[model samples]
Target: MSNPNLLVLATGGTIAGSADSATRHDYRPGQIGIDDFLARIEELGIPANLTGKQIANIGSENMTPAIWRDLHRAAVTAIGDPVCDGIIITHGTDTVEETAFVLDVTLPTSKPVVLVGAMRPATAVGYDGLRNFANAMRVASDPDAAGRGVLVVMGDRVFAARDIRKNRTRGTDAFAGFPRDAVGLVTPSALDWFGAPWRMDETARFDFSADLPDVPVLFIHAGITPEYVDRLVTTETRGIIVCGVGEGNMPDSVRERLIRLAQGGLRVVRASRLGEGLVDREPEDDANGFVAARALNPAKARILLQLLIAAGISDPAAIQSEFDRR
Candidate 1:
């Protein structure tokens, strides 16, 4: 008979932004406080007993792995609370995918963790943050939303974290879920569903107590040099992710250097710079013990590699198996 208790974590983004005028482009993100943001949501009559906190007030571009660890710890503690039925995260669109991906693979709970954000400032005309926030509450309160890992809600579209990427710069429909359709749609009267539901919580192998290892991503281009590879190796970098031109292919010189590093016990992941596609193993990559990132983009591939290394799985074959997941 009681309403679901919701835990909302506001990590400043456009949803909490303030512009002097509705049409003005100049504004400050996270200028609005969490209580003010929730007050408007409550006025819309979203049926939940809301409890929240402002975890951070920076734009998503400034997101760090330290904050990610803090978020995971907060989420774990909140989910373990008997009074909390679900969780929502207000984040900036620029790096929501990365944050969501980290939480999706690290959190142990099946309770819904819905991340929502706006493409426009809260003070802007045609502001969509309130609507998106309300929809996030509905999705979070729904029992069906459980066991789906972390979900990103925006523009009435719902995407699983592992499959989501920010595809537009200014549009309300800024997110795109590649290699998979959105799991649900927020209709005027109901939440419509489609496809089978899957989550990474059951099989996630990670320990975030240790900070994400130093793993830099390299975007391959014409006339690449082996010197870049030499720098990382000499510096004792834990891992490297190469965003190659196509199907995860790098220039001949760079590929040779990557092979050399892999042979020398450095973990290397081959990911695609192109959007939407799997980077499967090539015969040559396998021969050199380089791991293919399969469907993961370069950024997400880097996140996974950090977890893999931190979890103490350094073998190329074992790391490749983790990336091969659907």
Candidate 2:
């Protein structure tokens, strides 16, 4: 697949950042347009035929569900197009994990869909975006990259979208595949895989025809009062994910309120606040009609929960099974 046709979707992040001078650390992100970004890649001596499109120019912190929907649609179109061999997304590191997870679960495509970001501004003396961008092209063009789900290539490793998380504010090695490591690694000249193809959710793809239901993530803290929990929740809310402490435990007061809410036909999931580890289903979860997040972080769990509700699967047990598979 030499000189493969790749669709590069740009949703501004640090990779497009620019500063007053090459050494100046302060800068504005998403300043470079997709046209200019593709030109820079051409300077790297890569053989791929790249086509660029700008979906949005905001920082990933301001990433919205609307942009996500557009991005997914674009990927699906690219997948079905015989001219496009694969898809690449240039995004901010802050919320790249969320965007990737949304596409991974919703867009079902065997063509490679790779997301890449840079920690330093494009004008920085040691700009890493160019290298990372080149690496993304290499991974996408690799024949073995097909059917590996969506991938996040950063710090020279390829991470499946299911477990990618940004752990650092600055630096090239800013992400980790928590509870799981990179499925493969890539460079400008080579691509390597650690194991056989592992598609976590081979049989499920979320429907995107309608607006995704908003599922809020509730942070559980010590000494939280029942009034605090009640004030934030309302009857119209469809689902909630509790980012609890240590194995997803919350204060008794908050837990009781959540249980009551769950019994009233609201979907609830418990996820850990800590960086690493899984939230297993406790003894009373089934009785209370609550679901454990399993291996997903709070942000990712919220996405999965939203898609579940949008698909009209309200049973907690059924949602739990999705948490198990996806």
Candidate 3:
């Protein structure tokens, strides 16, 4: 069979960085071109036809909803072309999970869209950017990888966009604990295997509006006053996500205010501040009338709320079901 065509969209991060020639240790983002990165892959003898585009040059923290829309549009347009087989996005490690999740929900494509990044900049010794990029390209080109929604490939592990998280700060292996079945690993023989296989649901193609809601997220801390909740509800916030303490538990005062806010027709979701475990409703826990956030973090929960608002899914029951389904 002929080789697959891969489009490498470079959004600036440490992966596309280079050391200051004068100073041996200092590095800057977007210092290297995608062509240069591809040249390294060619030198390593990876078999694929590669093309490059520089979408943006900033840390992932600086990425915005507007950029997400642009990326969605770009991926859609690229995949529509006859020569394009799939796409691999080079992104910053920070906030990469959020970007992957947004694209996974918004972009309506069965073609593989893989996101890859590196913890160490290209200037660092033993940098893994090129290897990660090559792996992502391989995953994107594989026809078996299609219809899995957006994927994140880092350190030879593949995760569904919905479940991956950056657990470590500066380690080469930063991604961990997606669903057991969603994890994709590369064996020493270079064969790809998935613990869980994901297929796109028919409901995955709902219209995604480019406009996003102005939702705010607030974290509930120990001995925290109710004023924080009050201010968020009374202010110009369209929605609110409360990062409640363990297992979606919050202080009594905060819970009371959230219940009142729900009654007032504002959207409120209860998510856990703890990293792991699912958030469920408990009657004795004072969490009545509040929607459970399930496995979503504060940022991701907010994104889901924004997407729901954009898609005109306002009912709390519907929103709760949507979160639970994934």
Candidate 4:
């Protein structure tokens, strides 16, 4: 059989950084090219025809909607190329989940798109970039990984892009668990892979950017006041995602105003600030007319709400059903 063609699209992150001589342990993105990064991987003796391209050189914090558009376009273009079997993206861990979610919804392909990143810089002692990159390449090249939509492979775990999150600030295994048993995990070595089986069909394929509105997510911290929600609602944002307290609970005062906005026809979604557990809908809270985000984080929830609104899905039952479908 011919070798699988894997496209390594490099978006600057700690994984692609190199130590700068001027500063002790200082790292810079885009300082190293994708070709050089792959050269380090060749030492592992994995047999795959690899090609590289540098799409950006900044940390993922700098990633914007425009950047997502560009990345989506790149993946779409590559999928059309006969030589390209799959695509692997090396990105910063900061916002990898968000980018992956966007691609998972937008990219119209069954080809594997594995996103990999490192919590520690390439210069750190026992940095995890090389191993993560190798494992991601292995996952991307696997025929079994196809038709799963966008996936994230880090610290040897495989997650569906829509459900993954950067749960830890500094850890090799930052992405873990799911609100539901929708996807599975991979072993430490790329030689073995396991998880809940996944299959994406036409119904699951969503037009990512079709009617996405400019929605901003606001996380409610301790001591949050009504003014915060008032400002967001008044800002004329097409949609708003409230990262509510445990179990998706919001302050009664804040909740009241959010309901007012919803009544006015503004899109509002309530998501959990806590990592795990489902958002419970209170009978009294149901009058707010806002939708519960279920298992999605504030950011991922925002992405979905934006797309759903853009798709003109306003019914509470339909939105809830869509979340359940995924």
Candidate 5:
């Protein structure tokens, strides 16, 4: 049997970063090219037939909605190609969760679409990019990986897009699945899965052909004034996600302004500041037109809200239903 034909869309991150000193960690991200990256993977004799394309060679922290639109369009084109059996996205760890979630919610596929990144630069002696790339290809080639939405392969752990989060700044184990555990695990020798592949979000695939509306996230803190909230309530802004204290709470002064905005038909999501946990809707939430972010962090909540608002779905119940499902 022939190996699975994988189409790799490279959006450079630490995996493509390079440094002059192998001992030092300081390096410039996105210095390597797609050909070199794919060649390194082939040197390891990874079990796949590989083809590569460079989408954007920039740091993931610099990831924007425009790059996401192009990435989605390329993936869709690859999905339709008879030669492409699977798709792999080489992204940076800083914003992989956002990118994965965007693809998971907006791009549906029966074929595997795995996202992978590395902590160390490509030039490091302990360079993790090749191993991560190999494992990502493994997941993409695995028959069971199909229909599992978007997957992130990082440091032996494989996370589902809906639950993936970047947990730390500098470490091999930077990624994790919050509230939920990893869907699979991979190594040079073996592959193990905890569950069967399932559809991600079935309601709709959000169109990213145009510019997504600006929906800012406000991370609340002690002494954060209502003046901050007022800045987000502009004619051009669509929605807001407050990374509130405790159970998505803010000072009454700031809360009042958000409530007024929500009551006036603006979208407001109350997402927690913590890494993992649910922010359940309260009676005041329904009364004041707030959407509880459930288990979503502020970053993920912002993306969902942007997609919702861009689609012109403003009904609080309908938006809440999406926050519930997507």
Candidate 6:
């Protein structure tokens, strides 16, 4: 049997970064070209006909909505290609989860989509980009990896997009799986399985092809003033997501302002700033029409909200139910 054909989309991140000295602090991210990256992967002899496209060559910290739209279009076209059996995305770790979550929710393909990244630059002494890239390709080529909505392969762990979070700053094993454990693991010869995650694939959700509206996330802190909330109302922003304290709580002042905003017809979501755990709906929160983000982080919640609003979902209860399901 012929090996599966895989398409790799490279976006600039630490994996592509270069520095003169391996120990040097100063380096340039996304300095390498996609062709070079593919050539290195070719040396692995993974038995696949691999093709690559350089979608963007900038650090993922600079990831913007415009880039996201372009990437979504590219992924749709690539996945539709007859020769492409699987897809791999080389992205920066900074916003990797957010981008993966975006693709996971929007694309309904059964073929594997794997996202990989590195903590140290390609030029660093303990560079992990090459190994991670090889493993990402391995997972992509595995038939079992299909139907697993967007997987993040880093170090030796494979995470589901809906549950993965970048947990640390410097280690190669930066990503942590949540609520449910990792969906799979990477070994020397093959991809091993733990179990499949709860996926919303083919769930008849709306697409995010249009522009995402201006929905900003406000992180809460001790005694955070409600000035920003007041301004969002003044500017007539479509929605607001508060990364509230502990179980998605805010100060009394901020909560009151947010309640006012929710009462005035603007959508509100209470998401946890904490890395793990679910934010259940509270009685007071329900009274104020605040949607609980469940287990979604602030950034992911924002993306979901943007999609819901764009689809004309204005009722908080309906929106909360969507968040609950997805």
**Would you list the clashing residue pairs of candidate 4?**
211-310
Candidate 3, 184-218: lDDT as tens digits: 77522263756334564323445555678778888
Which is superior by TM-score, 2 or 4?
2
Write model 2 residue lDDT over 1-326, tens digit each, in one string: 35899999999999999999998878999999999989888987899899999999878999988899889888988988988888999999999999999888887657889999999989998899998999899988875787788999998999999988888887788899977888888899999998877663253387764476767788878777778767767766899899999998898888899999999988989998888859999999989899999999999998999888988999999999999986
Give a tens-digit lDDT track for model 1, residues 101-185.
8888788646889999999999899999998988898888887887788899999989988899888898798888977758899
Model 6 TM-score, 2 decimals = 0.95
Best by lDDT: 2
User: Between candidates 2 and 4, which one is better according to lDDT?
Assistant: 2
Backbone clashes in candidate 1 total 0
Better of 3 and 5 by lDDT: 5
Cα displacement (Å) at residue 326, model 3:
1.1
TM-score of each: 0.95, 0.96, 0.92, 0.90, 0.97, 0.95
Kindly report which residue stretches of model 1 are placed more than 4 angstroms away from their true locations once superposed.
200-204, 231-234
Error of 6 at 307 (Å): 0.8
| Per-residue lDDT of model 4, residues 1-326, tens digit only | 87778998998898987675434455775456787888888778777889988888788889887777778778988977878989999999989988998888778546889999887777777788888888887788887787778888888777788678777886697777565432545543444545533664422356657336778777888888778977766555777888888877777788777777878877777788887757755575457777777778888888888888878887766776776665
Taken over the whole model, the C-alpha lDDT of each candidate is 0.85, 0.88, 0.78, 0.77, 0.86, 0.85
Better of 1 and 2 by lDDT: 2
Clashing pairs in 6: none
Alpha-carbon RMSD of each model: 1.7, 1.6, 2.5, 2.6, 1.5, 1.6
Q: What clash pairs does model 3 have?
A: 181-196
Model 6 Cα displacement at 72 (Å)?
A: 1.3
